[model samples]
Every structure is written in structure tokens, then in C-alpha cells.
Target chain A: MRCEKSGRIEVSNLCKRFHKAGKDPLQVLQNCTLTIEPGKLNVLIGPSGCGKSTLANILAGYDSPDSGEITIDGSPLKGPGTDRLMVFQETALWPWMTVMENVIFGPTVRGEMSKKEAREEATRILELVGLQDFKDKYPAQLSGGMQRRAELARALINRPKVMIMDEPFRGLDDLTRELMQEYYLKIFEKTNCTTLFITTELEEAIFLADRILIMTFLPGRIKTIIDVDLPRPRNYHVLTSKKYLQIKAEALEYLIEEGRKCFGEDCNIANTMVDEFRRQADNRH
Target chain B: MNIYFVLPLFVILSFIFFIFYRQQKRLAHYSGISTLSQIKKTLTSQRFWLVILGFVLTIGFWYAAVYWLPFDAFHRLPGPDEVVIEWLSRDPYYGISIYTKEYYVHILYSTYRATVSFLLATILGVPFGLLMGWSRRFYEYSFPLVEMIRPIPPLAWVPLSILMLPGVEPAVIFVTFLVAFFVTTLNTLLGVQSIDQAYFRAALCLGASSKEILYDVVIPGSLPYIFTGLQISMGAAWFSLVAGEMIAAQYGLGYLIWQGYSLVKYPTIIIGMVTLGFIGYGSSAVIRYVGKRLMAWREQELGGLGVTYEE
Candidate 1:
């Protein structure tokens, strides 16, 4: 999908290695290259244990790739900066700091402005997040959904060029998750931020992303990129539509195939041979 | 157990009654006139007299312990009267001046020395903790040395303190400082380390300098831990002060208690012990009170509990 190139985030030839048992090296992401369009919600989805989270971490500067280049608006990403703010799945709002203080924390610490000025800026963001009343309340005082909102407010308060998220709503109950999805969509509509979100939830990825980058299993690489040409501010009703079901089925098929591959199971099978194969395998065992 | 035991038992029972009475009184005010009548009925019961009886019983036990105990190995020690008489009628060679009642003087001396040393330790310990807590290089290099030295008791340093310092004041101060210094430093370090990593990330992303992180994030984040260290260090100061005085001093409470031991004056020794106990308890309460007030923000996060450390 063609979108405004106001902020382009690109990762080229990304490579990362982690130490495994027996001092054996496990390559996490090998020569993975991708370009995320500016002001578009790009979702990364894959089967469990895939390297989507790792890639997101690399982009967020939480982890460094052994060799790669990640550039935002043509500037290379070296370490964590206000240029990119990350929202984690489990809300990482500071329990000690109040909602207002947590939101302003980044700006106040980084900005040359006075405390009063920083607070005013924070107040504006708090209102935007529908948490104006929770300014004085600690994270514990907030509901789980509210905490996530506060976390989003904290990240967005800085007006970062790219918003990177890792399973941002994985743990919430169904109702809360749906509510958060709606809330998140509304916020995205307002800001139009270039977002790179990682999730294992196929439906969530399809619903939120302009382009969903499906990944293969371990030592992950992009399996395919499915562009969701859905209209802006897509709602829950759109989930049951023909196009939505078509996309969901395709994503599910890809994931199930990947799962079979990981488990050493053949993806294709015949009904007659299934029983015979099981009997043969059982006899051999 | 008899009536002697009855007094303590009664005191405990009466304490329970007082708590219930207070609860009823609070409920009465909250629940309007109906509950007021109920509260009054509860209050009018003979439970109040039971409290009075309990107090009388305690006095009776005291008099019995004082007047009737035979001067034997385990007899209830001297009653208040005998102890009072002994206190009043004693001929004072030096008298009860600011310097004489070694109980009072020793308390003063011990308190002064411990306070001065603890303050000095705080001045050094807080900064050191902040440095070690905030700086990777400092934490990596200094933490190992601190860990090795921290477990070594302050009493172990008394000999070194005496040899190193030119005077007795220096020695006592050094020993007390050592006792409190580690607690303050380690507590501050933990406090700094325990601060949410997000706070640092938030600040760092904001373009905060390392110096700003120390002053703005690490110090404030670790204040609770620093206060905790100070409180613990106060206790350590008292402990080390006594040990220091016992080994190489002539004036503090420990020295007086030691002198009383040499002379076989058990009461004097007990008085000195009580004095030390009272000072230690009093200082702790003060530290806790101040810590709570200063760390009001912590209470919001941790309920009424002062500071709850997270693993």
C-alpha cells in the first residue's frame, strides 16, 4: 500500500546470534531485510518461538543485532532514543510514578524545558489518552486497560517517529482485549504513527496492521507480506466480513503449516494413508 | 501462677478490652443514635473495673516482688521502693551532676558519639551508594570490595580504629561510622538498583545526561533505601558504640556497665543497660517516623508499609 513517506523505517540484512547449550550458537534472525512504510501500522506475526519479538526488540534498540542496519528517516538506529518509543505487552508503566509523572518522565528528563512546562505538555497527552482524572493515581490504581493506555501515552507523549510494540495486548481477557483494540485503533487514527507491532494473534495482526508481515519458525524470515486494504477506523463488525474471513483463513493456514514443519509432520495427507501411516509408525516405535 | 501472674494476664486482657472499647466508640460516632446506645451499654459494663482491678493487681505484684522476695538467686528482683530508696539514700562521692550519674552521662556520651558518627557515615554513605548504584564501572569495581568488607562486623575494626586514629573520640567515631557506613552504603545501593529500569530508560530517552540521571532519577529513586540504611545504621551505630566503648574507653554507657560489673554493682549495671536499650529504641522510632514522613510517596505505592523492596 502506498502511504505518505513522512517517516520511513528500514532494516536491511539484520543478523543476530544467541548462545545456546554446549556453547553452540543459535542464529535468531539471519540476513532479514524489510522496509516499513511511514505512517502505516505494520504488524509482524508468526507461530510461537518465531523471531518477531526479537526483530521488534532490535528495532526498538532494546537489543543489538550482530550485524545489520536499522535506519529511521535515513538516520541509523544505534541505541534507544526518543526517535523510537516502545510499548511492551505487559504494561511497563512505573508503579511508583503517577500517571502524569510517568507520561512526562521522558520529556522532563530529556527536554531543556522547566518542570512546569513539561507537566503542561504531559497534561495535554493525559487528556488525549482519556486518563485526565488518573493524573495523580499510581499504576496500581489504574485498571489493566488503563495502565496500557498510560503506557501508550508515555510513549506517544514524546511524539516518536516510530512506535514499536511487542504483544501489546496478549494477556488481556476477551472483552478487555476487544475494548483495547478499539481504543488502540482510535489512537492510531489520530496520530497516524509509523508503528511496527509484533503479535502471535492472527486476528489482531490482521485487524490492526496495514500490512501484516507473516514470519516462518525459528531463525525466522518473512514468509509473506499480506497487505490489508481495509478502510481506516475498521470496527468489530468488519471482522465477520468476507474479506476478513478470507485473510484470517489464509493466515491460519500459514501458521498451521509452520507448526507442522516445526513438529516434523507432513503438511499434506490423505485420509486412507493417515491410518495406515499411524499403524506403521506405531509398529516401528 | 497465682495473683502475681494474674496482674500481667489482666493487663493483657484489659488491653483487649481497651481496643474493643475504642472500636465501639468509633462505631458509635459513625452509626448514629442507635449504635450510640449500644456503645454506651458496652462501655457501661464492668469491663472498665476489670481494667482497674488489673492495674491494682499489677501494683500488688510489684509490692510483693519488692518487699517479700528473699535475696536469693532467682527471687523476683528488688521492688520499686527498695530500688528507689537505694537511689535516693546513696552517698554520692561525685554526685548526680551532669557528669556523675554515669547512667545519664554515659547515655549522653554514647548518644553524642553515635549521632556524630552516624551523621558522618550518612554524608559519606549516601554519595558512595549513589555512585555505585548509578555507575556501571563503579558498581562492577567497588561492589566486590564492599561485599567483602560489609559482612565483617564493625567490632572487628575496633582495634584498627584505635590504632589508626590519634584520639579516643576519633576511635569511637570511626568504629560507629564503620558500623553504620556499610548499612547505609548497601541499602542505598539496593535502593538505587531497585528503582524501575524504566525510570532510567525514560530519562535517558529524554536526553538526560549521566549526571542528571544520578541527581534526578537514582538519588530520588533510592531515597527510601537510603533512609532505610540510615535507620539500620543508627541501630548499628549503637551496637558498635557499645562494643567500641567496652574495648577501649572510660566514659560511655558500655564503660559504665563494665565498671559496674567490676565493682559487682548489679543495679548500676542494669540501669546502664536499660539506658542503652531506651536510647536505641528511641532513636529507631525517630528514624522510622522521619523516614515515613519523608517517603510519603512510597506509602502511596506500598500501602502503609514504609518501603517494600522488590526482587
Candidate 2:
């Protein structure tokens, strides 16, 4: 499929600070610059609380950066618009609405499509996400993986120019998570939508990205960008490939250094606990 | 019976029955049982028998208290049998019973006043509360005044309401509305505030206008709380209505009770109290049924895993 020329997101010199009462302001993001090319799956990997989500929120237009220039298709971004939709870390499907209603909400509310047309499109998208049979079910009725799929369907039905996924599969069980990742990869490949996916999982980042943007510990900025030359239409087999392992090792090294910096003294205590457990197991043997 | 009065009464009763029947059918549909089967199941359940046993025990206790208590006050109070007998009499000693037009008039007047006050409170209070929760500017400007006034009990406003309002009916209604209004407003405001921030962000990202957010996100998000508020407001309306009627009105259950007391007709007082309890219970049940119908999505949360019908 030929990718559309639109949906280029260029975020430059982004800075954000969070104010706390009776304390100094916390700088969450500083001098962050990245470009998400059209129809590419760009993944951002960072340590927890390293402001990766802050950058995603700014890009999605939920929160504003203190000083930054964010442009979509060469036009400066304003507040939230239909052109960019975010899939939240936690399921953001409207619990009161069924999967069908949730998916059709954007188009119907914006008057971009008639209710009949929106429902038809929503049915297709729900089918794409394997939620067609569950269209009338509420978000509360769905399992975590299913809810994420419904959320994806909701965003996809909008045909958003840029799709932002913030740890969308964070809470699913291991098997379900792996299944969802594969399912999501197939959808992404088919649509070839421009996407900026945020994750703390190195494996997930390497497996799904066309390019991986590694973020620094705090006052988060792009530490480095690793281009993934893996062929498209990939699967679980790619996880064991020679190139995948090399990329994972390099990404893990960077993440470990950043993780050490982020954890500081706490990291030493965790290591000590692990050492103690190993010693106890050796004595038992 | 007057045709004019009886016709309206028959129409209203049939309307209420129609709604009740439809609600039962819908509830059964959701539960995957027919209405008749559900009713049969409830009747056969141990819980139903336990409820009956509870009522019997309570009445038995009331009988024991009335007959055996040695206190002068206990002697002055009418027994359960005496009240029940008077309530059913065609020509009773207290001049109020099933056959009496005056008894129905009192019940109708009380019901009318409570319904009007509750409706008025809901119509005015929901929007006020939504604005208070939605806008910081509105909250800052009006919340303090609401707080200041809410602390004053509805009964405390009886004297002032009578003075300011044109007549006794308005005064009674005003007092009742105050209590219901405050309850509805506060609950609705809290309801709006309790919504997840992510839902708002999602709505914004979908390019929803402010008005769209208000309708699509704010209203539905707060419905559970709004319904809860309505139930409480309905109760408060009746509470304040009786108090207001006792002081200012010529006809109502409260007026009937006060009249019975002044006339030393103890059975009449018991009759009025029992009637009030039944009507109040009925009104609350109606509100609950309506709330459940509207918030069908919340059923799984409320009823838990057992009630969920998996496809």
C-alpha cells in the first residue's frame, strides 16, 4: 500500500514543567525534538516517570508544552483536533457507551459522517480489531485486551492523521499482551497509519518500531534514535532473529544505564536483594 | 364517586401500572427470564419469606407493646388492630377510612405537592450543579452562597417562606423545594466532578466542541450520581413537605396527622403515618426503577458477575 503524504509530525525543542505546592517546579521534558514520518510506526522507549507520557500528551494536544514548536503536515498545532487521536494507557472507552457507540462517537459528533455512515465504518473497524461480535458490549464487559482493541477501533474509525498509543497494552497478561501486539502489528501494517507508540518495554519497542527513539531518564529528551531495518509484515519469529537480538542488546544497554540513573540508591538495594536470593538458592542446592 | 375526580384517578393509576409493567418486562429481558417466571422465582425465594417473617415479627412486637406495656403513654397510643380497623372502616370513629373522600383528598394533595416540588428541584438543580462542576468560575461565584444556605434546615425556612410567598401552598412547596434542590445540586456537582479526566481528554482529541462534551461526556458520565441524587431528593421532598404542611396547609397527610393529634384521635395519627410511609416508599421505588432503566450499562457493576449474561 502507498502511504499518504500527510501526517508528518515535527516536534522541536519541547519543554514542560509541572508546578507543586511548597516545592520547586519539576522539569518533566526539556529540549525534546523528534519527527514522526508519515505511515511509520515510531516507538518512544524510556524509564518510568521519564516524561515520555508528557511528550505524548503534548503531541496529542491534551497538555501544552511551555516552549515548543509542534507542526502537523507543516501547519503549527493548536489544541486537540480529530487529525490526531490518542489511545490512552488505561482504556479510555466511554464505559456508558457500547463498543459500537464509542467507535462512531467522533465522526457522528463532528458531523463529518452521518450516523448511518459512521455506524457502517465503525462496524468495519470493530471487525478489523476482532470486536465485531462484541459491538453492543460495554467497556466494563470486555477483558483488558478486548478493551484495548475497542479503544483502537474507536481511534481508527476517526481515521486520525496521526495515531498515538501510550502504553496501550501495558496491563494485559503475558500471553494476551503478545497476542494483542501481533494483532495490533497486523492492523498497523494494513492501515500504514502514522503512529507514535510510547512504551517502557525494550522488546516491544524493538519489535514494533520502524524507528526507535530512546529517551533520557528525567527532563526527558531523545537520547538516541535507532533505525530498525527489519522487513515489514513481521511476526514473533523476528524476535529470535540475529538482527533483532543485536538491536535489543544495544537498546537494553542504553536502557540499563538510564534505569540505573533513574533508580540511583534504590537500584543498589534491588541488586542486593537479588544477590541474597541467589545465595540462598545456592545454599539450598 | 365524582366522575371528574374518579376519571383522572383511574387514568393516573393505569399510567403508573403501565410504567411498572413495562419496567418489569425490561428487567426480565435483561436477566433472560420472563416477567412471570421472575416473579415466581422471587416468590419462591427464601429471601422473600424472610422479608415476610420480618414484617410479621415487627407487627407482633407492636401488638405486645400496646397490650403489655404499663406506661401511661403506651395506654394512650392506639394499638395496630385499632388503627387497621379504622383504616378499613366505611364509617369509622375518626371520620377517615377507605370509603371517605376526605382521606383520598389528603393523600392526593400531599402526593401532588411532593411531586411538583421534586420536579421543580430537579429541573433547576441539575443545570446549576453541572455548571458548578464544569466551570471553576461558576463554582467560585455560587458555591459559597449555596453552602451558606444549605446548612439552614428546610423546616427553618417555613416561617420565612410563608412570609415571602403569596399563599400557604407556595410556602409549603418552597420549603420542600429548598431541601430537594440542595440535595440534587450537591449530588449532581459531585457526580460531574467524579468523572475520569481521561474521558474529557478523549472527547477533546476527537474534536468535540464544548457543547458536545457537555452533552456527550458530561451528562452520561454523571448519570449514576444524578439518579442517586434524585432518589435522595425525592425522599427530602417528602420530608420537608410534611413539615411544611403541618405548619401551613389546610389539607395533606401532615395536616391530617396534626388534626388527628389536636382532636385526640390516636388511630387517625397512626393511619396518617402509615399512609405517608407507603407513599414515600412507592415514590422512591419509582425513581430507582427509572434510574436502573437509564443506567443499564451500570448493571454489571451494580449486580456483579452473577447477573452478567455472556453472549
Candidate 3:
């Protein structure tokens, strides 16, 4: 289900550097160029310290690139605005506010909708996220999964042009994380809004992305872009599919290579141990 | 026993019982037990019995020290029984008690001074602290001045306050306000600093204006610390209020205590001390209640975790 095309983001030669006292400037992102097509889910996959989050911050206008340009629908972005909303990895739902209040915060603050309209829209969005029962509950009262859902509702109600999710489900348990990935896919399929989702998980990238953009180790840059041609309306069943396995294997190769560069030989030894253990289990079976 | 002593004892016992009954009811609600069973459980609980035993032991020690001890200091001090009787007496031997207009007047004056000082401190301190935390330039310029002045004790300001202010009342208030103001401003500043940077970034990304960020993100984010500061400030206000009152005020609990000493009424001094304790406890309790109401989100967090209540 594709919606109207509006949120097309273009990044050209984006670069950023952080300077520490009495130390040389550390380059975070170097000549990062990418295009997030309107109405598509683009997953940017990378290892830890790969500057993917920094790139996400730059795109969301929370930080500016040292040198480069970012345009949304052919207009250069000036500063943080309602047009680009970010769903942070850490829980950012205002704990003081109830789920309903958090969901309606953007529209109410921006004066984009009337109070009645905002409430109605927020109610619909909460229902969509299956949080209608917990609308009156505070973030502290909710579980991690529910808080993430509430955060998503907070971002979605605004109808932002580009939704930047920076490792949104990074800290969830395995079961909850998978459930959220499936749940997120449903919303993405329905809204078909342009999304730049960042993650370190290869399986998550293959499971949810319309296109997977693999980033190198710091100083980060796009290493490869893999188009996911898997059938839509994705679920856990896709994990065992032949196409899914092929995409995962390919993405794993690049990820492991980058992970090795980032974490050095330690990552390689850990990877080898896992492979050895897998072989032993397979031989027993 | 006299009616005055008997009536007050009954009221105090009833209040304690009421608190226990309410607590049992709440426990029963959470644990799905009958209130009677919960009350029974509470009575039989070792924790409850231990607290009772501890109180009994302390009072027994006090009684022994006053009646049996040979020390001169022990002989001069009033026992718990003597203080309680004198506190409730209609025609008190020391000329201050439940029936005395002077006692009520002293209490009213002290309470009035503390309340005014606390209100003033809050009005000035919160915004000042917010600006200090919000703007880098403001913090750099004003924080040094605050640090320089904060270390000097509020009591140390009494003589200077008397010399500078128009009257004794204003002087007492000024001295009390100084301590509370410093506490509130520092806590509020720390509260703002404690806020996670992620929240600010989220607000900016959500397209909230600077004013909206302050109201929605910064204020709410720093509220837990602000409430904590307010509670501490309330305590500080009373602390300095009593000191200031003792030095300069003509009517206050502090003055009553001082006057009792000068007049050689040891029982009156104990009565004043007990009254001060109850009022100070009540004032802090009010601030805590208001803080709980304002930050219901924090209450839920603490409640969900089953953290025990502490003063």
C-alpha cells in the first residue's frame, strides 16, 4: 500500500568532525551521500561507533554537517522543524505526560490542528499502535515495548515528511524486538511514509527495509546499498525464507567485515567461535 | 487524670490508629486481602512490634534519666510526662499552654514569617535557577556570585539583616529567605542539568519552539529535582526562621523558648520545643504533598517500584 509521494531526502557529501581539548579533531562522517526515496523504508545498517546516529542527527536537523547539503523535496533544510521528526533510541516520551498527551504534543505545540482534531487524531494513532487502553498511563508506568509504541505514536501523529528512527528498538528483549519489527512494518506499509531507519542488526534490516544501506566503520560512509525484493506485509515467517537467508548472508558478510575493522580481531575471534559452535550442533543433529 | 491531659492523649492515639488503619486498607487493596486480615497481619508483624518497642524504650530511658539519675543536668531537664502535661494544661504553671492566647499568637507569627519567606524564595529562586541552567552566559556570570554568598550561614546574616532592613519582622524574613533561596536555586540548577540531552534533541526535532521547549521539556524534565529542592528549602526556611526569631522577634515559638529560659520556666521551654517540632513537621509535609500532586508521574514511578516511605 503506497501513499502519496512527498518525502524524498537527498544527502550529498555530508561530513562532520568533533574536536576534543588537546586532541586532534575526530572525523565522524566523511563524504556521506545517500538518497532516501519517498514512500520507502530505507534501513541504514552499521557497527557501533559507525557515525550512523550522527548522520541521523544531521538529517533530523539536531546537528549540522561540517560540509555538505541535505534537501527534502528539492528544498534545503534550514533547522529543526516539524517536517522531520526523529524517534530516538532512548525513550523520549515525556514521562510527565500521559501517552495521549505525548501523542498530541507535536500538533498542539505547532498549532497545526485544532484541539478537538488533535485529540481525535491522537486517539486514532493510539488505537493503531494498540495503546488505546494505556493512553492515560504515564511512560514510567509502561513497559519498554509500550513506551516505544507510545514514542512511535508521538512521531506519527505529526505526519512528518521524513521519519528518522535511530535504532528505535535497540534495547528490547528478542521476542519484543521481533514483535515490534513486525508491528512497525504494518504501520510503514500503511502510511508508506519515507523512513530512514538505522540499526546494527542484519536480520532486522532485511526484515523491515525496502532498501538496506550498509555503512562502513568510522569515519562512516555508505559501503553498499542492497534492495530488498522480499514480498511485503512481512512477519517472523520471512526469517526462514530462502530470499531472506540470501539477503542476510550478503549483509552479514559486509557487517562482519565492518565489525572486524571497528572492533578489530576480537570480533573475528567471537565470530569464529560462533561458527565452530554451530558446526558442532549441526554435526550432532 | 485532668481532662486536658486525657483529651489530648485520646486524640493523639486516635490519629495514630487512623494512620495505621489507612495503611492497612491500602495494603489490603494491593494484596487482595480483607482489611481486617491486613490489620491483623500488621499488628503481628515484627517490623511493627519493633517500632513500638523502640518508642517505648526511648521514653522509658527518658523517664529514668529524669527521676532516677543523680546527674544535675538530668534533674534540670523535664521528663516526657512533664512536658506532655504542661503542653496540654489549661492553666499552665509556665503561663503558656493550649488555653493561652499568647501561645497561639507566637505560633501564628512564626508560621507567618516562615510561609512568607518560603513563598518569596520560591518566586525568586526557580526562574533564576532555570535561567542559570538554560543559558551558558547566565551561568558563567551569576553562578560565582551565588556560590560566594551561599556558604555564609543564614544565622550569620541576623545582625546585618537587622541593621539593613526596616524592622525586626523584615529582618527575620530576610535571614530565613536567604537560606531557602540558596537551596532552591542550586537544586533547581542541578535539576535542569540532570535532564537527559535526548529530551532536548527530541523536542527540537519535533519542531517545538524555544518557549515550548522550556515549558514542555525543560520544566517537566527538571521537576523532580525542583520538588526535592522545595522540600529541602521548606526545612531550611524553618531552620533559619527559628534562629532569626530567637535573636530579634518579640513573639514566636523561638522567642517563647528564649523567654522561658530567662524566666526560669524549664517546662515552658520543653512545650515550645515540642510545638516547634510539630509545626516544622507539618510544614514540610505540606510541601511534600504539593510536590507529589504536581509530579504525579514521579509518584507513579516510585509507587510501582514498591519503595518504602521515608521522611
Clashes per candidate, residues 3 or more apart or on different chains: 2, 0, 0
CA lDDT of every candidate: 0.77, 0.87, 0.87
Backbone clash total, candidate 2 = 0
How far residue A112's Cα lies from its native spot in candidate 1, in Å, is 5.1
Taking chain A by itself, what TM-score does each prediction score? 0.88, 0.91, 0.92
Say which prediction, candidate 1 or candidate 3, comes out ahead on lDDT. Answer: 3
Give candidate 1's error at residue A19 in angstroms.
3.0
lDDT by residue (B32-112, candidate 2, tens digit) is 999988767766889879988999999887887788867666777888988877877667898998779999999999999
Clashing pairs in 3: none
Q: Higher TM-score: candidate 1 or 3?
A: 3
In terms of lDDT, the poorest run of 10 residues in model 1 chain A is: A269-278
* Model 1 docking grade: acceptable
lDDT per residue as tens, model 1, B1-311: 34543554477579877867777776666555565586776668798678878978886776775567564542545455444333343343223222245557777788889999999999999999888987789899999998898888878888887789898888988988886988999999899889887677656766778887777678778888888788889988988888888878878888877777777565565556666776898898798888877766677667543322221
Q: What fraction of native interface contacts is shared by candidate 1? A: 0.42
Q: What residue pairs are clashing in model 1?
A: A110-B206, B66-B79
